[model samples]
Target: MIATFGGGCFWCTEVIFQHTKGVKEVLPGYMGGQRENPTYEQVCSGATGHVEVIQIDFDESQVSFQDLLEVFFKTHDPTTLNRQGADVGTQYRSVVFYHDDKQKQEAEAFIQALEEAKVYDSPIVTAVEPAVTFWEAEDYHHDYFNQNPQNQFCQVVIAPKLQKFLKLYQQ
Candidate 1:
């Protein structure tokens, strides 16, 4: 199964999904943008209309799409618009690019359930859209958290988010 999500910074999002049991691979990339083969600097300008996304190839037999959505919602603040911590831009918008009808329906249902359960203090703003062209980010952007664990942004931002996810969804 394949899942693509743009919650905020791909570095943080990729790190969280990497620890999930059934995830086979997590590739950090750019999606939902107008530019083709956009560079990191170009996307950072926020004019490309691309959101930093992570494409996760997982084993559905072990981890369902619904399960992946659950982790996605929990790991990021869906209520925030175009921002996550210091990462602020349309590139940081909350979005899910579904690859199939079933994934689309499941994503919609999950958002509906979250709204009904009042999981967020504010309405969920996660955009459910069809999967678009995904341009893989440069090599340095991939596994950024793992590579730069001591970096201030990773320490203060990504680390806390990862910790929250692990504590909330310990298996």
Candidate 2:
């Protein structure tokens, strides 16, 4: 099964799902956009209508979609519109690009449940949209956090966030 999500920077989202069990692959890319073959710079400009998303291929037998959903919510702030941490723009907006009706329904219901429970202090602004064309990002973006661990952004932002996720989900 495949799930595509846009919660924040692709690198940040990529690292989290990469550590998840049963996640066969996590590919960073552009989705929810009208532009064809958008580059990272173009997406970063936030003018292409693209959101930085990771298309996760997972084995449902080993890990359920619900489990992924839980991890997704816990790792990123869905209440904030068009932003996660200091990364602000439409590309960082919270969204689930569902590949099928089941996925769409599940995504919507997940967000609904979170809203009903008042999971966040603010209203959930996650968009559960149909999955569109996924333009695979440049090769350099794949496994970015793992490859660039020495970089400050990876150390300061991604590393801490990844540790927090591991503690919550892996423990």
Candidate 3:
């Protein structure tokens, strides 16, 4: 099964999903945008209206979509609108582009449960839209954290999140 999520940087989200046990592939991409085949530079300009997203292909039998959602919510601040930590823009918005009705329903239920349970201090602003065309990111963006572990942003921003996710999910 496939699940697409946008919860800040695609690089960060990609790294997290990559560490998941049943996730076969986590392709960093641009989605929920007006532009066709948007480039990273174009999306970064915040003009393309594309959110940095990851198209994850996972084994549902090994890891449920709900499990993926749990990891996603715990790792990122879904309560914030169009921002995550230092990254701020529409491209960094919290979103879930559901592939089908089941995903859409599940996402809605998940958010409802979180709200009812008061999971966050603020309400979750994560958008649950129908899946759109996924424009795969440029080659360099793939497996970014693994490829450039020493990069300053990776160390200061991504590494800590990755650590927390690993501890929480044991991935």
Query: How many clashes in each candidate?
Result: 0, 0, 0
List TM-scores for all candidates, in order.
0.97, 0.98, 0.98
Question: Any residue pairs clashing in model 1, and if so which?
Answer: none
- Name model 2 segments beyond 4 Å from true: none
The RMSD of every model to the true structure, in order and in angstroms, is: 0.9, 0.8, 0.8
Model 3 gets an lDDT of 0.93
Per-residue CA lDDT of candidate 3, range 1-171, in tens? Answer: 999999999888999999999999999999988999999999999999999999999999899999999889988999999899889999999999999999999999999999999989999999999998999999999999999989999999899988988888764
lDDT tens per residue, model 2, 1-171: 999999999999999999999999999999988899999999999999999999999999989888899889999999999999999999999999999999888988999999999988999999999999999999999999999989999999999999998887864
Residue pairs clashing, model 3 = none
lDDT of each: 0.93, 0.94, 0.93
Output the lDDT of residue 157, model 2. 95
**Preferred candidate (TM-score higher): 1 or 2:** 2
What range of 10 consecutive residues in model 3 has the weakest lDDT sum? Answer: 162-171
Candidate 1: list runs displaced more than 4 Å. none
Deviation from native of the Cα of residue 73 in model 1, angstroms: 0.2
